[model samples]
Target: MKKILKACLLHSTAVSVSLLSFSFGVRAQTPQTPADEISPPVTDLLFGIERMMGSDSTLVETALEGFEEKYGDAVRGGDHIQGIAMTAGGQIVLSYSRQDPSKENCSGMLIYSSPFDPASPNRELDWDFYCETSNTDINNPPTGLGPEAHPSSLQASGNILAVGTHGGTRFYYLGPNGIEALHPNTAVLTGGRDSTGLTYNPVDRRFYLLNSDGSTAVGKNTIRLCRSDQDISLRQANQAIFTDSDCINIRDVYVSGQGANLIVQEDGTLFLVSTFSTRDLPDNLLGFADDNTDAIWGAYGTRCALETALLPGYGFRASFEDHIYISELDFSNRTADLVMKRDIRRTQAVQTCVDKRPAFRFAGGVATIRNGALLGLWSGRQNPPLLSLNDSYEFAFQDLPQPIKSASVSEEKAYLFRENNTYYRYTDSQGVDPGYPASTSRNWDFDVEGDDKEILGAVRYDNGHVYLFLEDGYYSRLEKDGSTSPGYPVKITDNNWPGLAPYAERIRAVINWGNGNIYFFLENRGPFGGTLLGDGEYVRYNIAKNRIDLGPRSIEGPWGILGDYDTDITAAVNWWNGKAYFFLEGGEYIRWDIDTDETAGPIRTSKYWPGVSDDEDITAAFRHQR
Candidate 1:
């Protein structure tokens, strides 16, 4: 009697069992059993054995032969599989690209009935989803192919399969019947370009597209998210609608690299892999190996096939050309390590010479199977093969470094100031960080010693100079090169400013107009607490002349001219529009024109700034020009 092996296949959607049971001698034939009958641990052990012996071993080979004989050859003699996806019900879907690009009926899809069972017979069905001849005219009734009609990427969720094309021109979805154009008559997503990558985010139940938009000229390519639950067919046409409100803008997250592929880990963390250039990696969320060269070859027009996969117990694995780089990510520390590397050429004969070099062309597609095994497809091979790696490798991570407390940007660089009075400048061109002045002394100028006074506030001027406000009415100036200006750390009273003599000790906030003047908000704690000084004083410094001009005046608000014991000024910021905004302790804000000294509003801050929480305190705010 043959030994019957029962196993369960756990997937994102539904669970199923393998019909072809493994046996030493004759293959054991059994009806499919419910997955619940087998415990998870036992199923895992069985799957582990299967993985060790390899999916294409004699057992699977016999099963494949039987399947072809029963169901017809679903592999289609090894057609080029452009995209692979698994449904929630344990069904596998493969999108095949046009073997002959010039032929109209070359692109189609194959639906496999038994997803996790390698022994399962041919695909359940195969259909032509892409008709290039009919799609040649994009504006016609039949819905012809646009410039981006060549499907290059695909993602599946539930019962829908989303197909993306090159040039980011068109998007389509394949349902049970056939393929249908998404937002068919709508102009909602017409503006984006280069739709090379697609993924379904289970956490938010939305579809994300990695592509570039109209702002690509300025390196603003980004990840765009579409609502998954929408009735896409009913969406209106000619509506230039797009969602960037929650979309991840590459410019904001990464300082330099343009995004190529995006992956959302099981834990909801999103990782974007870079392509083509040697741009600096992001310091948050995503991590990478330092040894991996940044010389990925894809650009807008050039199609460089790069792919990544999330390992079950390991971190992430990415493939480019003939090399595969595996990384271990420590999300807690926001770091990644390139733990291992492998050359695909050594395992398989994958070379088709285009020039003098072995053409690995279009060989970076990878997917994970239900049994925690990795499946990869290369341009040289039509069928996806299992990629084996050490499952017991360990990874270590370093603690994430704390970022600077505050930052201000200028035209050429961004200055990040820490609480320790040390500052670092990052050049925009190269994203390189140049450390602060010698650590031995606080002052960059050897002539003067830097003060240890905690920084109260800081502001940058248009001339590239920064002014630092400190405790006890002392201030310092830092030039663009991170060096102190001559005669630094001067006392506010000694700067020849008038009207601050009485309230200089109680200064609360400072604002730099960025032109040539700086303003100060001061509170007066007069003699005997409730005594006769004013509510507060507003002082101005003429930076060019190194003197105070029109200040030491009583702060006036809509409530009335502020009296000595009135509400105090809590926060203030220069809006960079020749106006300064001040917040009061009572939650109201008033705007003052720096040049005219005229005041407006005692209105609620929330009234002017939409989306701001009412309970949020206005601590600090600044604006930067793109």
Candidate 2:
């Protein structure tokens, strides 16, 4: 046996199984060590590797206990948070303006030693060291980002921290010593265009911005997607193409606020947040982008928002008034909670207009980080896969739609079902029927409950009606007029169908071969009784005989095309076009040549269906020939 044996470290997904085999003396060896030095045995080394790979530790974030008071202490009259970002290591960076109306003013950035304990902040740094005022020293690099500075933006991805100013975007390297500015040569100069809100996308390796439309007159803000990392100009920034029905000027100038910020998700969905809003868009409007069509920020843009940050597992956090909200993605004011509130009066409380609201101290700018990086997003994964042609009418599937559970085709329309009784009435030429992807009602007069309608498999039989295998071993038939056929939806029993009664509850898909036969694929229930490796099998029934003729064969053995995924077949469709399709888990389907019996593909459902995610599986499929 070669010392470097297959059973040693070559386990694909069965590392534990191999280890057990090796320990039982199937082929155990001591193995090699680093530098030929004495080291632990093979078991010890492999166990260490397993422990390292299975590590589930995450960065522990401290509560923002004293964030508000700390903000009041660091800032004085007219100072407000400008931008904020967090590194992958949970380090925080904040930028703010110290511009007092009476003075030239100053703006500066601060780096916190993560989970930001305001009491200590960064152990190595002091607030007095970075912020110098124009009143005291105008020429020297005294404090802040320089005298008379208006606003600056910060973005941290992994160890790379970037700052945006009129001089352009400056990069920084974060080390044990703290953040150090990179050389001017590495800086991406933006021709004095101070990107009010700056973010770095790790996936695309580019910087994105939130800036005002050249007309500061209207104060309209538009997203600037920097095409070139080094050159972020107007031409490169303007990439928005609105829908035909949308009001361009309204959506462009919709959301306006101080210290506005932006955060993009991995799939190109972004949120444009603001500290406070005066004109346009509501509050926390969701933003959508069409990267495939080069149409960005069209209609799905948001309303009012604050500095926002997305944590890996804890979801998004946004501060409003005094409370911070957390949700999977819900930034809406209605459902979001942390539903706390507090307000501090600045100066003296006076009557009428004299009592101007103080600038919001929290969410000045928000960002989340991991692995010492920005944990960037906007990877350009288009969910809708929306496309536009020479323009008659453009169409695409809705984003993140759930996968269909079962489908049946008729002469004119096809019916598709999802969980929660949602269904889509689809068509071939006109695409999906309007007012579909709707929910089916549980108002059926049958004794069956609501869940009993969930379709497990479906097929348009040799008869004129469509047959549906429903939940709880029940079945139904639909007429051409979209109404349930009379006296239908009965439970499956050995009396009606002989051999199928035993496996009726396990049927995953039902198909009509069109040659006077129906076939069924019963789903595997996991190694039968939990002891055997019992894979599911397909059964063939003869419509002429009204009974199962030949069946109970191993799915993988008969259909060599299934490979190692015999138990994973969720749906089967016999296309009217001389092809049979087998749908598997995770939106992948293979084409079977009925005549040749050779498999053509394991193609992605998204490749043909657009909106289906790779993780969404097809439960059942159908097609009927008139």
Candidate 3:
């Protein structure tokens, strides 16, 4: 019987994703009709916060409510919101300059930050952005722009913020306090002339600036990409290099800087910040607030890049008025890219600033409209598999003083870890035997220093043999005489392992599903170049054929009564109960019934599993014989 367990991991060392620690107040999760949300009228609407998520240049909208009333109207760019940049630490920067060369070129940039770090005191900023430009002008300014002129666009990465203008693009220092609006340094790429629609790529440490053909042909434009190696806010020289997709005209249609708005993700994948016109959708069906733009945008396609895609690039207008909205796009359909609003945010707990789709809860069952069509009254994934519980555990796990690194059933159940290069041998009869937790000296080809020496995951075969997985596609097995199998540490190649080779580097855990097949969980990272790489997908390896038998599939459900989880499914064990028990990052356990393929209980380990903490992370789990 598999424990009613369902946890999915999205954690990785190379990716550096901030764990979900933004607990501001009592988490009041009122289960309601799943739909888009429209926050109450906020005085200072700072930014529409966005994060580069998985699923091919996908952008997830987050709700951010509180704002400084004094900073009202600063974020209102009126189609002139040429650039919106986000820092690695979750700071949003917006640029809006008055297009008129008439008055004193007065412009301001507003920054909103909820530093992903839970440690810093200011990280809990109550969702406010400070206005520290040369001058301050709020609601009183004519058209709210307040003589705002060019710094036509903006882009950011790490701690550096770049502001682009018709003359040239300059860099500014973004310290912890606020942006150094006073000091402006020039970047080498934009020193000669004006540039707009710029973005930063963290993957390769390069800056991609959008260059247009400077035409006014309606719905037609030619755009290219400029690569800069100099670090942000630095003054260096490098010519604009355009080749392949960079040189080719994505779509020879449009005016100056009006093709597809450029946005490069951390993984160096290029995408367009596309939008849709939603004026025709019935006001009742769309459920938008009184104050908003005529259009809604919610997609960044995987095929909008220059070189590879044949379908035209350069997105259409993202908004019709000052306050724009975002909607979900149906990428699979591949027809009309845009869709109307539906509160997918409520299901994901995504807080945002300007998406007023509607309250998640409706009086009755609601109809989710997509692409001007009804998606039925039922909610999609109403709730991410929440491993929540009404009952509390009386006792906590005390055995694992340190988090388990790699666990497998072997001679006394081997647990190889990196705490000073040692492993623990726990027995079902006596628990930790005398002189346990010994060094990994005897493990052949392992027992080295650094990352190569660490065991990421371990699994046991029916014969009671143990296998240890290492970094860069290598694995070793234990022999009968308490020694590693000779000629071990072999590469898990396509010829040998077939289905698991390409992902050998990203595998976080392995499981021997007592049913004669092995399961491997793959780790995923975000916005790699063009797609969300390192997707947390799992594959089933058939022991009989020694190749992939089932999937490279997502843990999201329809998964045999096993709902998906937002957290990472770190480790699992084929328990003695004849079920597969899975463990998550937070000490929660669930199981899968081998016979029925039905799943049950993501109950806290504190209930039955001895010595497990509430928030303890389990790295490896397996059944062992004494």
Best candidate according to lDDT: 2
Task: Give the distance in Å from residue 470's predicted Cα in candidate 2 to where it truly belongs.
Answer: 1.8
Candidate 1 vs candidate 3, TM-score winner? 3
Error in Å for residue 531 of model 2: 8.5
lDDT of 1 by residue, 462-554 (tens): 666666665666667766655566787667665344444455566666667667777776665455675365466677878777666876666
Model 2, position 533: C-alpha lDDT score: 72
What are the models' TM-scores? 0.31, 0.35, 0.34
- Which prediction has more favorable lDDT, 1 or 2? 2
lDDT comparing candidate 3 with the true structure: 0.38
Go through the candidates in order and give the C-alpha RMSD of each one to the true structure: 24.4, 22.6, 21.5
Question: How many collisions per candidate?
Answer: 9, 16, 51
TM-score: the better of candidates 2 and 3: 2
lDDT of 2 by residue, 73-149 (tens): 33343343444555544445555444333444423434233332211221222211123232322122223323224
Candidate 1: lDDT of 606?
A: 57
Which ranges of candidate 3 are over 4 A from the true structure? 1-68, 73-82, 96-107, 116-130, 133-153, 164-168, 182-208, 211-218, 222-626
TM-score computed on alpha carbons, candidate 1: 0.31
lDDT of each candidate versus the true structure: 0.36, 0.41, 0.38
For model 3, residues 166-219, the per-residue Cα lDDT tens digits are 433445544544544322213323221223444444455545555443321122
Superposed Cα deviation of residue 371, candidate 1 (Å):
8.9
